[model samples]
Target: MTAAASDINFCFPVRELESERVKLTPFIPDLHADLYFQGSAAYPELYDFIPWEAFTDTSDFVKKVIEGCVRPDTGIALYAVIDKTPTGTNPSKPTSANFAGIMGYTNTSPANLSTEISYALILPPFQRTHVTTNAIGLLLQYALDSPPHGLGLRRVQWKANRLNTKSINAVQRLGFKLEAILRYDRIFVGSKTNAANGERERAGDPRPGTVGTDTALLALCWDDWESERARVLQAMDRRS
Candidate 1:
């Protein structure tokens, strides 16, 4: 459908999205512990471009997930990424799924029939595996599906730090095209220690020499998805 003809009141339903390797379910307080464990384990590596550090406990993690990530009023829907493979020592026996990470959609603009996918965080074990690939494939399929099946959005965007080559490569491999770079897009303040001067500064001190991050914008519009859907789906299935 054309962007103008698409429903302006389109709302993303909170539900589960599954692929061969991963399952995405609506975020809940009950899953906070598992989310915290996985996210905290990844720690500073995952936080390099994510703009947030690992949580100290379930309470801290749940508060951020509720207040920051899954704000329904703002049209953001967060999901817990669960690993579908067997986790216990018994490979032949089924085991409870483990929380691998989190991902979701934000910056939704129904009037424009567009939304940006953001806040994807997968643990070390799942990185470079087919889990993320399949998760994104599932999301794309749902976002682009026609009425009675999905939202049929005209545009789906992906943004990342310009210096984050890993993230950029991941999305590009998924068929998103690089659009532009937003210069000095976000400011991040933190403590600095001067070895020569033996001086220490606390976070948010607002001192000089602080640098901000530039955002690299990428997108998969309806036309792009239509043209590339088959190939992308084939790649996902092949990799699965």
Candidate 2:
């Protein structure tokens, strides 16, 4: 395998964090099966755009996690969010790594130092919890931290289907500035990819499904990220 390249310095491998009632950790091999099932079941509609088959097997998912942790350039950094059920209470609830989601750059556009951001999968009991917010905060914080890996970061962005209001609101609530809705700018469910790079062969697939046309592109920049992280952390402090 190629030695981790330009992006190796950009990631924090195996990061761990506590968010009120949950623990966010790097994706572990054992949790792959559950994570795969949870992610696929949680968002079937997103299949057209994402490659879910790669995670069907425990080994494959484990490999993916390993790659994300050790490989640069290619693999997106992944984090699994686990609920911390308090055993100190009346009844003890099982605590385990729940689902896997990722955040990283696909490509940085030349016009500006902007990068795309994507995160998902909060299976079953984990849905609608503070974990998502906390994880997102961590992602933004990591992106804007300081020199070295963080120096080139100017914008963090999210793009989803025109009808994906839930995604739109979620990013907006986190204070991402909605930039533009480029008409027919994406190609989903087909072979033409319109990401920062024009249509090209996928990393592994020569003939991937065409994910045609999407409109909304929500974005958060270093300025907005600073304010949002402060608000989120302050709110967390108040709750504690």
Candidate 3:
């Protein structure tokens, strides 16, 4: 039997994380999947760097994203990035929620006290806005701040496709330093020739006809948080 949405545990406490500009809450498929599918379908091209193709429907999102990347056993947490800033189009509804995107913590390790932030999908309408900055900033706080304030994780890692300059830029701006370039980081089954928006894998490889990618790994450690946290807040405060 399928467990109830609220009953599902992510191996970490699911809390409502927010800032003046953005809010991130646990993503419950029963409620947000349809909305996510509608938004994602409109901008399939946005998933150019993702290992898998754009979702065909809500069911596909649940089957692939939920079943694949978001595993409770693995301690992954998916969040709904909600825009909270007052839109000029609807000035009267200052607190209205506008669904912006999605983000997640993957490869979370409670014992090791680390996690990786991955799968950020900012909808077209919300791109290049404060949503991205505050959304990411909020997660950083939740993950790195000391107990009673936040999770106090020792490290937060971000892995982006080497070709994804925008993502690389975002993480760098948030104070993550480049550690290494992970070659052949992931395999996109059936891609056969190209590596999901990245360079093609080397030819004559043992696993022939497999699409792969090189990952640019960047990390923000507890040692850097005190200073970077201040920088992140200033960036999130900017209006664009």
Candidate 4:
């Protein structure tokens, strides 16, 4: 029998999730400075993919966090990814965790027992590390585990810009299968400036100067998770 939305206790206000290398904490307004600084200072390339580049300022980040990320109805639960590894040479000394990036679930649909993973933003240094792999594994575990452990979701979806080969490759490695390409799926406002010359030239006729991007859809359904979960956890355990 399919569990109704009411039957599942969705983690509200985002709960804390931990892995060996990192910690995921619910987004709070007080994190505005940390999030802004980590995102802006580490790499300029972050602005290329993330649409919220304009929110580098603490005030804007706070406003956006309140209005978009933390809002209960938005169906987007944000988490601040923090690095838990010890930094200084002193092994016994306690070191504070550093904010590594942001990631979360979006377009959550409890009624359908499905959710979309979105807003993966790992800092450049944290890239290629097990941080992302473990983050994803943890999220998958939470979304797929049965009641008393997780949301018991039937499906978890991942969508990336078709041009984002890095993102596609990452998900593919993590066990999400390619589903389909959504043609001209999203219209990014002011994308013209960022679009390549060829892309701009090809924007002919109907929407001359507009820039649209195709979306690549991928998913790991319940059955797939059941089959792959052990292998995935084994890989994560090795990394952890």
Task: Provide the clashing-pair count of each candidate structure.
Answer: 0, 11, 0, 0
Residues 1-240 of candidate 1 have per-residue lDDT tens digits of 111211112255656687665677666555334544545564656776655666776677666766545643456766666777644522112123466677778888778988888778877766777778777887888888777777898999999888788888988987899999887676555431211122233577665544466789999988998888997787677753
For candidate 4, lDDT tens digit of each residue in 1-240?
122232223343245677776667665545434554645564666656444555556676666654545564456776666777646422122122366677888888867888888878777877787778878888888888777777889999999877778888988877899999887676665563452222443534565655666779999989899888987777666653
RMSDs, each prediction? 7.3, 7.6, 3.9, 5.9
Ranking 2 against 3 by lDDT, winner:
3
Q: Which residue ranges in model 3 land beyond 4 Å of their true spot?
A: 1-7, 86-97, 190-206
Candidate 3 C-alpha lDDT tens digits along 1-240:
233555355766778787877778777777677778888787867767776678788999888887665754457888877787645532122222477778978888999999988878888888888988888898899999999888989999999888888989988998999999988788766652333545544767787666777789999999899888999999989975
Q: How does model 4 fare in lDDT? A: 0.68
Local distance difference test, each candidate: 0.68, 0.53, 0.78, 0.68
Best of the candidates, TM-score = 3
- TM-score for all predictions? 0.80, 0.62, 0.87, 0.81
Q: Between prediction 2 and prediction 4, which has the larger TM-score?
A: 4
Screening candidate 3 with a backbone cut-off below 3 angstroms (N, C-alpha, C), the clashing residue pairs are none
Q: State candidate 3's TM-score.
A: 0.87
Model 2 poorest 10 in a row by lDDT: 89-98
Tell me the TM-score of model 4. 0.81
Q: Rank the models by lDDT, top first.
A: 3, 4, 1, 2
**Residue 129 accuracy (lDDT) in model 4:** 74
